[model samples]
Target: MPVEPDPTRRSHESWRAILDATFELLEEGGYESVTMGAIAARAGVGRQTLYRWWPSKAAVVFEVFLDKTNIGPFLAGGEDFPTQLRAFAHGFRTLYVEGPAGTRLRELTGAAQTDPDLARAMAEQWFEPRRAPVRQALQEAQKAGVVRIDIAPDTALDLVFAPMHYRLLVSGGPVDAEYVDAIVDLALAALAPGATPA
Candidate 1:
């Protein structure tokens, strides 16, 4: 007699197909072309399955996007704050500028413009979790007397991070390894204790 399928394995496979299909669709037609029905059909899963796991296309999209971004703590350079900043910036270069992460981010962010729910999900799910570790690292550095405590944590995050993003989305400037090191160094100088805000 034939054995029954393993429910756990089957479930995992189903979700994997769904996730893969979502990205495939994203690459093919972008955000507007993706719909729940389209994802279900492309994934070879039932519409009910999509609804069971996620409420909408954006929900599933962000969920899968989050899975792709398990890069870990942003400032994992070294024990020292300066070292950590350098390492973090280099890692950002490798992943965001050098790798495909930046493209996916540009796509998601642009799509999030019209969809409030998607924007919120992207922030609450994708952006905030990744920012948490970096934010925590900054907090620890503040306690260590490396980063100035006067600046808000979120502001500090933007100070170091915004440059890369600006280049990625707006300036179309260089985002090379040299630029990464320069930005990190600039951030360190600005955030150094007793450094006055301009």
Candidate 2:
């Protein structure tokens, strides 16, 4: 028996279907192999629908990257910002270190080196959103007089995240728990007044 399509499902089905197809294509064939026609056919959607939603394949793939990964540690739950920040760090390390998606991330980031548009979109859409929670946590830390207010939030974010990106993209080293703890400690130290590096 044919399953009756749910109307609510139909409304957002195309978007979900598209992302699902993107993941499949990415896993099976990598970023270079993904094309609009292939994605549309995989999703069972029309080319017009795909074009209407995403201006380019890069945008579609970026969205799929966001959807498949947990951006922050906590999912907007009951924990305080700091606790959630810790959780977010843990989650981030898990994905960046051991997850299957890490390889795809490396490849896409490599491709972004030549593709300016993808690089911009990846930074704006994928990277910025991931940092938002840490930004909030830093703000909270400032209000509590734990973090020096002189340092800008963006700077704080960079201090905390830049190392991980450097390791992931450039150094090609392992992202272990010890590394995460060291990163958190160093970033926090920079934000502390009269704090000297040990």
Best by lDDT: 1
- Tell me the TM-score of model 1: 0.77
Best candidate according to TM-score: 1
lDDT of 1 by residue, 9-66 (tens): 4487888888889889977887778899999999999999888777677677676667
For model 2 the TM-score comes to 0.72
> Could you give the C-alpha RMSD of every candidate to the true structure, in order shown?
5.7, 5.6
RMSD of 1: 5.7
Candidate 1 residue-wise lDDT at 86: 74
Instruction: Itemize residue pairs with steric clashes in candidate 1.
Output: none
Residue 146 in candidate 2 has what lDDT?
A: 72
Candidate 1 residue 24 C-alpha distance from true site, Å: 3.5
Residue-level lDDT of model 2, residues 5-70, one tens digit each, is 346534477777888998999989988899999999999989998887667887777778777764
Candidate 2: where is the Cα deviation over 4 Å? Answer: 1-16, 44-52, 73-85, 111-120, 196-198
Error at 35, model 1, angstroms: 4.9
Model 1 scores a C-alpha lDDT of 0.77
